[model samples]
Target: MPLHRLLYTSEARLSDNASGADLMVESIVAHSQANNEKRGLTGALLYVRGTFIQALEGPLDALENTFERICHDFRHARLTLVDMSPASERMFERWSMTYLAQNDEPARLLVNRDLEELYFTVSTNAAEAMRQMRGLLLGEGKKPALEVV
Candidate 1:
């Protein structure tokens, strides 16, 4: 079956506190992993400077339902669907939901480069940007340590 990918960026409504952010990340990962695994979905989620950039891949109905839940999620605000299209294959096949807490220079640089253009304009290079974002999240040769609830 053909895969579908949904990439979105959203402003986080929670306060930026060390413990709070950590707890929120844990909660999100735990919840997402359970749901995505059950639905046979896969994705990566990145949180940086009170912003969330996520890419989810799966069947069309599952992806759409997941996006709908995200749209109504209280933790997110100003949620923008950055890109949605048919994907030839899954970019994150191993992870049900990988959570990356952006704290490094490379992630910062990539986010700076892409988020502005992605959030403001309808760029034809959105797919490339999404690919780059996925790379930045998963490229460091180290998988993010997602806490199991």
Candidate 2:
């Protein structure tokens, strides 16, 4: 199976309550972790301002099947595929699903940027999207100079 990577953005259809939204994201990450582990898939998820930006990398077949399920998931609306292409190696090889939430330090770094603008940037530039996602994961504990435009 060849390695492949996919990037996408979507509107989160969760409740207005912050706690409720948190629970929903938690559930998503937990479920994704289990499924992706079994399927030999790895990815990172970024949730901010009711929008989700994710990157999935693994076997092309696994990626396709997983994305099919995501396409039908009710929690996501207006899902826009940003990029899909062959990958030499997995960008998120360590995690089945690395969840970066709104309150997370990485997310806080990006909070100053407008959600729509960030979405547009990622949608147009896959390299930028991967750099930002990887930066978010790498910047968990220490400060990494990450600028998202």
Candidate 3:
């Protein structure tokens, strides 16, 4: 039987700070990709300047269940979920997930810039979108992150 898939997208506003932003971003990207490789899930992360616009697609249940842990994760502030939909096309082919930053600079000095205002004004749904992604991965018998405890 073929597994059901879901595509989730999110935008978030975070507290402005130079410390931890870079490391958190790197860790999240690395973590997602690693998890994907282990589970064969596909996803991607995009950061514009200091804002996050991510897309994740995978099995239905695990993706949705992850939100419970994400909301608890609280690594960042003002997380918001913007889009959740079933994707007809897979954005990433092999990698469990791919991360892209929209910062004008691709290197450390540029990509490492700590301009938090870019996202602070944005909506807060990153966490919610993350939860949705988890549900997609886990599939069925899934509860919203808010219900997870």
Number of backbone collisions per candidate: 0, 0, 30
Off by over 4 Å in 3: 1-19, 104-149
| TM-score winner | 2
The deviation in Å at residue 78 for candidate 1 is 0.3
TM-score: which is higher, 2 or 3? 2
TM agreement with the true structure for every prediction: 0.77, 0.84, 0.54
Residue-level lDDT tens digits of model 3 in 76-127: 3445655555655554454476654444344433222322322333345544
Over 1-149, each residue of candidate 2 has an lDDT whose tens digit, in order, gives 78999999899998789789888888999999999999999998888667899999999999999999999999999999989999998788889997765454564545435334555678679878787677566665457445421
Q: If both were scored by lDDT, which would come out higher, candidate 1 or candidate 2?
A: 2
C-alpha lDDT of residue 6 in model 1: 86
State the local distance difference test value for candidate 2.
0.81
List candidate 1 stretches off by more than 4 Å: 104-124, 140-149
